[model samples]
Target: MGVHGTVAAGFEGVREEFSAFLTDEEHAPGAQLVVHQGGERVVDLWSEGVGGESLLGVFSSTKGAAYLVTALLVQDGFLDLDRTVASYWPDFAAEGKGGVTLRELLAHRAGVIGLDAGFTAEELADDRAIAARLAGQRPFWQPGRFFGYHAFVIGALVGEVVFRATGRTLQECYEERIRAPYGLDLWLGLPQSQEPRFLSTLPMLPTPEQAAEIEAAAASPYSLGGIAFNEHAPGNGELYDFPNSRAVRAGGQASAGGLGSARGLAGMYAAAAFGLNGRAPLLKPDTAAEFARIHSEGTDLVGGMPKAFGLGFQSYGAHFPVLGAGAFGHSGASGSLALADPRQGFAYAYTRRRYAFPGGAAPENTRLLGAVVRALT
Candidate 1:
């Protein structure tokens, strides 16, 4: 019934909002929330079902880290945004994808969302395997002509470029340059020592009405959305089960396999936009701006809904009105949301053990973010 952790004096409203939302929930959500104002921790709260140190799978929010790594490479001049992906990974040019640029691929414009034949569960857990399979697959649409949410494969596409350019995996780069240096809890490839802290993600418990609506809106496995999520695969399990598998957690599929708590999620963004733990900020202003600027807006070809995307992160400004322009971050399928708002001088993160109904960013984020902004003002 009570919330855990501390908030700065002025941020009591955020605690109140978090508690209010929990009180109304029929099920325990096992949630964690963390916020950083520049380099200072302002709010750190967790629900009864999850502790401040507990780690949960942060689905697509993993993409933010992947994107950040890519941004760093670009900032260092190791990678070029405008260069054709084929220029770096020659095999990527196969199947009429010779012209897909790194910029377009990061923007979800490459159209090679997933392999037509589908990936094995084992392959889905490995980014290199996923990349190899996708290399020969034809684009779902003409490259750069339209945009779709490359829900499951964007990381592999970008990671491939990173590997080709630097001779290291994205996870390796993230660990050496980002995670280990900051001692962040977020893990792209979680080590065995950290295994004890992980709390396996729970599936969504939708209300009867929500369940009925989902059933009504269900698309065929052959549909674009289905393929993007690899649901069309012959033996694919439910998307929620991906993180439960040890292989998936061990390999850290760049797309959605990150494991972390709210602290790690929030801290990673803080390190990117504002220096953390006395370290300098990871991203330069120009690099962050280029990655955060809206590159694709309007209907997503895969999701069949209005969406907005920056290089590899979601355009937070479009989805959360409280977030100012250029705010960038991403949400996970399990209701985890994390982002950095350089304009507002804060980085925020929220993670849940249980999936929320109508997934993506979870409904509670709006009120919670508004409360945080009000407290900041």
Candidate 2:
């Protein structure tokens, strides 16, 4: 297999950069890259071992879609961000979290990161099950005072609100409003018919040095970081295997069970920010700005590292020097990244069927993204 796809006239360098990155990889990354300059796709490329249309597990990048759904509802006045989560789902207040606003919850401030006892794989795959269990779980930190990743359950919590408010599953709303309408390849709840294009996500192939670094920073299975990722759960599978399960794909565990290609992702962000296919943008300018504004910054309590978060998206300006102040997106365990840079008038996405060396947005994005941005200018 070799690099295959198209690059618009000005983005030839992006194709060269993608080829160069795959050539240097010891393992075939099976990667795809897509860039949209406003609503017009400027680059579309894929490397060996994966087709341009293959839908691979996007891990946390799924949150970008989930957040977009939430933003739309808020924009339409179907949901209120300032209202307490308890107002929508009363059970959410059982653990003295009655006051946690929907805004705080989206920013990962509700503090019900994971179940105190942990979830079985089946429960973890079902957002309703996850939400029910978390309703009474005590917050690891005071609900509004501290923030953590809520790596596996934020979607369930937020989705519960959508369900209670609108009487529809978050997945249903997404499919009806975004995926089907746009003919996107991304699936929140992948149907049986679309399973042929699905590809299981590959685990990270870490270097000896990277493995040592992981071991050195290892936390207890019951620690906040571990629980947040469901590492403490009995019989919980590896993080990389979450989307490999048919149950997970069917249920569309909103936090991380999304399956998509680079085209789907880039198209999504482009639709939100720039009106894809000549249609109106999914989100109005005010909604996009509100979601992209920084809501939380400083060290992440669960990951124990510096991070920045907006409504439900990763704020890039503080940490990613290449992006402007309002750029927002999410990175996944498979080294996939997707986002819209409103100020720069572009949307970009990269996906991998093979996990990257260290994980969390392959480092090559620096060069690849730099190439795309430069081409735009």
> Quick one: best TM-score, which candidate?
1
TM-score, candidate number 1: 0.99
Clashes of 2: 0
Colliding pairs, model 2: none
lDDT per residue (tens digit) for residues 1-377 in model 2: 48899998988888988888686453385899999999998898998888898989998899998999999999999999999999999999996999999999999988999988899999999999999999999999998898889999999999999999999999999999998899888888889998999988777777789899888888999999989988888887888888999999999889999999999999999999999887999999999999999898888999999889999999876667888889989999888999999999999999988776566788888888889888989
* 301 Cα displacement, candidate 2 (Å): 0.5
For candidate 2, report its TM-score: 0.98
Output the lDDT of residue 285, model 1: 93
Local error of candidate 2 at residue 216 (angstroms)? 1.2
Give the candidate number with the greatest lDDT.
1
